[model samples]
Target: MWKKWMVCVLTLILSMPVVACEANPAPESQPAQQTLPYRIEVLADQLDVPWAMDIASDGRIFFTERPGRVRVIQSGKLLSEPLISFPAPFISEGEGGLLGLVLDPDFANNHYLYVYHTYKEGEVTFNRVLRLREANHAAQIDKVLLDKIPGSSIHNGGRIKIGLDQRLYITTGDAHEPIIAQDRASLAGKILRINLDGTIPADNPFSGSPVYSYGHRNPQGIAWHPDTGILYSSEHGQTAHDEINRIEPGANYGWPVISGEQQKEGMKSPLLQSGDTTWAPSGMTFVSKGPWKGQLLVANLRGKQLQKISLDATRPDTVLEAATLFQDEFGRLRDVVEGKDGILYLLTNNRDGRGNPREGDDKIIRLVPIQP
Candidate 1:
């Protein structure tokens, strides 16, 4: 009788689904005997190509549409009208368009917002960082802080953020010109920093130049570590070796000089590399102040997944473990931002030329931990 009951129990258990707890499941040596804590929820849908986003002071989500609109999601709804729209001069070519967005540090008081986008002049098209003033539900164009960044149909690096130093940092691609990435004199293929008024900080690594670091192929993501205040970047690789780098002032990243397995003198090596695989990483952020606080969340474009990179106990230079989330479930992902309320907002890039879009395809999905 006891043996018959045990057999029935075992059959029931075998029919149950296995749940995962660890961000990355343990190796076969040690199994994962746990259940995942969080669940993903779609906050809004029926949107266009949502690229980058920033949490507004009032808890609203401000995001950019790759075409040329600055949109908002308020009270859990995708607002129909855009906060502001740019002219048709914006070239929505291959990779060029309205790309990144961020709010001023003192957005509550200043109501200023910034964007990184691609614009054309006669025949030449390039990227620029523009500041705008927000008031009464609308934003007005302000200073063109930085402009004329080298751009191309594909490799237009357009991630911008306000660093811990209270300065604007912008990343630019090689404009498809691999040679310029090694040129210190060119702003293309470099991370540039400037004051709010578009002036170069005197304390910059390069005294008079806005270049913070050089020798990059097509960097797409930049975020600061919460504990150490160190800057981290996500860069795209040619055939393989997508990288996450620890940014050091004036350091070279060895773009055309050395790609995948090669590293040279004076060029700082990346903290992590995905060999023979392309994450095609985009906007990234750290989950600061949550159960998964220190984990770095990256949105993968071509890989069509959300990846989590965990640091070691000492929080040193190396990644301890890595895992994927929503693998191909939502198509391509463009940005992942952690809101002040500890919720993670993931922007879907399904409407982009390369992705498979459904009716009302692109969306912003919110993730929250399911507490025990």
Candidate 2:
């Protein structure tokens, strides 16, 4: 009787199929098709390297010209004069110039503004975060929130955004040193979260550190999901694999040790990974409403196009790469943002000394979805 029972149990166990729960499943994912019909339109021309841009509540578009000037565009025209310009100390060599900008949630009330740029000391040094108050047509420097963040002429990560909770978040690159990404004490290669007043949030993973997540090579883009309020970042990969990561407070993204999809024992994989050729994703924005509401719009740099990625938080593999439109028209697209009118805005980095610049190199292009 005991032998017969054992045989029956063995047979039952054999009938159950083995399931694979590995980090990287076999047969990698393929890109998806484009859902919405859209067209790209050139808005401005001959501007310097436009790094980052933000839409003001008053329906004005504010963007940075990498040579150290902030300009405004209203009603599809570039303003003759710049809004503000930093002193010589703010500009750096290659990727450093005026990089990021964000307005206070209560811009009408406080009129506070924030900027991220590489501060030079004798020669090109590291990047720093500065805050100021914006008045009628000028800005008053209030404080330097964080400084001495390792900066490289190449991989200086310069993107900042305020979350739905009103907390400030900044993304820093590895400064060309891959090992710095794994070091918790170093500010390089990490996403930092802090209070508006430059104090570290008490609930951060580490006791006194401002780092929310680590192990990033060069994270240039960050945005919050309109529905879930969860943070998402676009990180540049080394030779292959540009990533769209779903950021968690205490998570590590495994930079030097891992790139895109890793099969290691304990490494957080990317939510979506694209091959070396077709995509070099930069700034990303979530479609707030309309038919494309919940989809992610990723701006490509090398690939010279904007990719629409469908995301499913529960199943990471559900990130389908949609259309790769505007392949060569807007050379080396840098940032993709949604404006107040719900149209998408793209910043072209053609004049950045990489691609062939057309007549109006380094221009801001806007795209609107049309009904099919």
The alpha-carbon root-mean-square deviation between model 2 and the true structure, to one decimal in Å, is 10.1
**How many residue pairs clash in each candidate at the backbone level?**
1, 0
Leading candidate by lDDT: 1
lDDT, model 2, position 123: 63
The CA lDDT at 315 in model 1 is 51
Those runs of model 1 whose alpha carbons end farther than 4 Å from true positions after fitting are: 1-34, 313-315
Q: How would you encode candidate 2's per-residue C-alpha lDDT over 1-372 as one tens digit per residue?
A: 865665574454335443323343323434445454566588888899998888878887888888888888887788888888878777658778889888888877887788888877776478888887877766778889988988888778889989888899999999998877777788999999988889998999998998999989999889887867778899999887778788988887877667776533344677766654546677888888655677788788888877776666665445544556666767799998887667888999888887788887878887787765
List pairs with backbone clashes in candidate 1.
Answer: 20-36
> How many angstroms is residue 114 displaced in model 1 relative to the true structure, after the best TM-score fit?
0.5
Each prediction's whole-model lDDT (CA)? 0.83, 0.79
lDDT of 2 at 53: 87
Error of 2 at 304 (Å): 0.7
